[model samples]
Target: MLSIRAVICTLTCLLFSGLALAQATPRAPGLTFLYSLNCTLGASLPVGAGPNGNRVVIPITGGSFKGPRLSGKVLPLGADWGLIDSKNTFSADTRYQLQTDDNAHIFISTSGPAQSDGFIHLRIKFETGSSKYYWLNNVIAVGILTSGNGYVAIDAWQLTSPTKA
Candidate 1:
């Protein structure tokens, strides 16, 4: 009976251990951790919602139009990217990339004592895939105190990973 109880306990611990490990490290399959950024950033987007609506939106803020214009630095604490701007640009350069079929899962975490050099922006492009049921998962968090108080900025582009079957 004692041996039986010991075996049961060992099996239970092993099963639960796997679950805990999975929770700690979730991954989105088929995509590689492309690249990331910190501190300051930049870009430009063209838009056309209407004559009075969003005609053109571009990320032309970070630095020089032809140079590395973004400034600032942040530690990986928490808080994802905020929707500073959006345009009809056909580029996924501003965000992370995951290349799963249509049902790929994505997880993002943003933690930080945030800060900005009074600069932030985003642009949207065509979500292209062969699958018609493509889904998008977006999560943005802002842990920034840009006015009186101070905060650190962790540009999200720094943390990217991939998962494969």
Candidate 2:
């Protein structure tokens, strides 16, 4: 009878543990934050001195995109896009942040010429009335980028997240 009770207790604990992990897991289907050399993107991102924040989620094994849902009319990834020195889709390792309001954000890191700091990536997802915007910020840095050089040099910008359908 004691063994039966123990098994039941263990299973119960396992069930609760799984629930906790699920709640903690990040909402999958990551989104991308695009930065333009020009300000015509028409998207805006407001960075608040977030709460006593300390933890960051650096994606190690996942794609940088969740849903292609975007807004504010995607600036042609061609001559209209400034981030690209030339013209094309550049797949770079980026990062993002989440505010207390539950807005999903993505970021990228960059450094000026001849500097030795990592880059930054900031991704944000927001819905305003009937519009969805994505704000992707990139900070320039030295060698590989990390959470330290992640938060600094944030260049604020926004893109469409997706339609509510």
Candidate 3:
């Protein structure tokens, strides 16, 4: 009877251990909507097939962005030097400048791969000298790109921890 009780206790402990492990699993980071950028594009300047892939430079004419935190206009002086690999996988590499409605300048850089959903997923980084927008310099941002005739639209989001600091 003592041996049976011991076995039962061991099984209970194992089951509880599994439950504890499940409960302790880390949670995924949350996303906070950052901004939406809609920028007009000029003609695609094909660079032909390079050593890496087919390169193309698409000119950014101008655009606007808005969000809960900030609103801005994309300066008309940027380009997307995107590439298409042999497997036809598109990778986006872009650099742009933004001027906030309040007149602060922010430089933006983004790079990522095109997804199966016909949208490019971007890892965005920002640089700015304005103290008001300095937080953008440390932001972990992402964006989804959807391009249409003469333009591209990106909906950006920032990753946030579940707990407030």
Candidate 4:
């Protein structure tokens, strides 16, 4: 009887331990809408294929944006250094500068997967010294890129969770 009681106690402890370990972690917070910037792209200059992928460079021509908290024009000094793989998936590394209507200067970089369905989803980051827009420096942003007529539009969103100070 003593041995049976000990075995039952051990089994109960193990069951409770398993239940505690099985609980899921907390989910990340949702995204908040930030701003959208439309950029025009020049013709693609294909650099041919290699082991990594087929490389191409697309020039950033010029464009403008307007949003709730920020508005700006995309400067012309940037380009998308893109790659195309054997699976036909497209990815882009794009860097550009922006000048706000208030004369604040910002540098932006973005990269992510692009689908042939005419849309590119991007993870975006920004660099700026303007005190008015400094919150952008710390948040993780996501963007959607689509094109029509003569330009591409990027809709940007910010994750709502605050980062550690």
lDDT of 4 by residue, 109-142 (tens): 9999887677999999999999998988997999
Work out the TM-score per prediction: 0.19, 0.21, 0.84, 0.83
Q: Which stretches in model 4 have alpha-carbon errors above 4 Å?
A: 1-17, 20-25, 162-165
lDDT of each: 0.32, 0.31, 0.95, 0.88
Model 1 alpha-carbon drift over 4 Å, by segment: 1-36, 39-43, 49-52, 55-95, 98-117, 121-140, 143-165
* Lowest lDDT block of 10, candidate 1: 60-69
Using lDDT, give the best candidate's number. Answer: 3
Which 10 consecutive positions of candidate 2 have the poorest summed lDDT?
73-82
Q: Which ten residues in a row have the lowest lDDT in candidate 4?
A: 156-165
TM-score of 4: 0.83
Q: For residue 152, what is the lDDT in candidate 1?
A: 21
Candidate 3 has what TM-score?
0.84
Considering lDDT, where higher is better, how would the candidates rank from best to worst? 3, 4, 1, 2
State candidate 2's TM-score: 0.21
Winning candidate number (TM-score): 3
